[model samples]
Target: MARVSQEHLDARRRQILDGAAVCFARNGFHATSMQDVLKEVDLSAGAVYRYFSGKDALIAAIVGEVLDQVHEGFEEGARSTPPPPPDALLASVLSRVLATKESVTVDGRPAFPRLIVQVWTETLRNDELAAVLREGYGVVQRTWARIVEAYQDAGMMRPDVTPDHVARTMMASAMGFLAQQALFGPAPVEVLRDGLRGLMSVPDRGAGSQSG
Candidate 1:
């Protein structure tokens, strides 16, 4: 048999992943099956199985792609002349995420955002997925911590708090944005950026100031 070129193999893998994404986004994880994926891609069972063993594996691959992209954004930000502020960095991250072709379903609904809600719920019962999620987030957290340190070095952020603490809080906010996007249709990324700015801009009341 003639050997398949690497480019051909890569394209096939992309086809499977993209088709599975549409299926999962439309019907959800539990509702989507390997057979459903095969029908969506119009590929033979053997061909599709060559890439993903089952729906669990497909779901894991999709989630991994999303996390990997988020991680890459932080890596890029770290190398800039000055790293983006937490809010702006997150807004950029979300913009890239929402702009991906795979992020939208055929019906014009957000794909990854909906899948993310399912992934979070799946973590409770899927140990492998839970571990994958924890590992992915840990790497992202470390990347953000380095940015936090840079901010501290420039006196842009307070030195009193640990970098991990700030990183965790920022990540929590990003996750919250995804949750909201998943549940409530798309909102402008600026809303999140501006809201964070508003929170950070609040004037601090001096201890001496009090009601008479």
Candidate 2:
């Protein structure tokens, strides 16, 4: 048998994941069995199993991919700049995130949003998934919290605002926006940028700045 090339393998894996994402979006994870995934991809059992052992594995990959995409967007922007102004900093990262999630997947569905929400909903009933989901969020929360603190240190953000509070609030807002987009399709990037601009607004803290 001719050896499978790395590009082909990666493409195949992505194809399976994309199909699984669509199936999960259309039918609840529990309701959609491996057979459903098989149908989604139009692949034989052997071919499907080659990529994912079962639904749990597929769901894990889906959630993992979503988390990685969001994390990459933040890490990329944060690492490339020297703690840029909070407004510019956030604009860069948030725009990357909006673009990343809105990009089309191999299956022609939006890369994220609805698919992520579906897996999130499944976590309510799935202990394993919930654990993974929590872990993923914890990492994101900490990373963003540090960014919040950095902004404070730079005098660009209000020092009185707890880092965790700001970070969590931003995260919650992003999640809410994602849920909305998932249900109703893509939202204008301007609305998101405007929201972030408001959230990250840094009041002038010149000489004798008041914290009240």
TM-score of each: 0.89, 0.83
lDDT tens readout by residue for model 1, 19-92: 98888767777888888899998999999989889988888898899899999999998877568888899899
- Per residue, candidate 2 scores C-alpha lDDT tens digits across 46-119 of 99898888999999987887778777666654554346654455556656765744544524656467776877
Worst lDDT run of 10 residues, candidate 1, spans: 101-110
For candidate 2, list the clashing residue pairs, or say none. Answer: none
Model 2: residues >4 Å from true position, as ranges? 84-111, 199-212
The 10-residue segment with the lowest total lDDT in model 2: 100-109
Give the top-scoring candidate (lDDT).
1
Alpha-carbon runs more than 4 Å astray in model 1: 1-3, 206-212
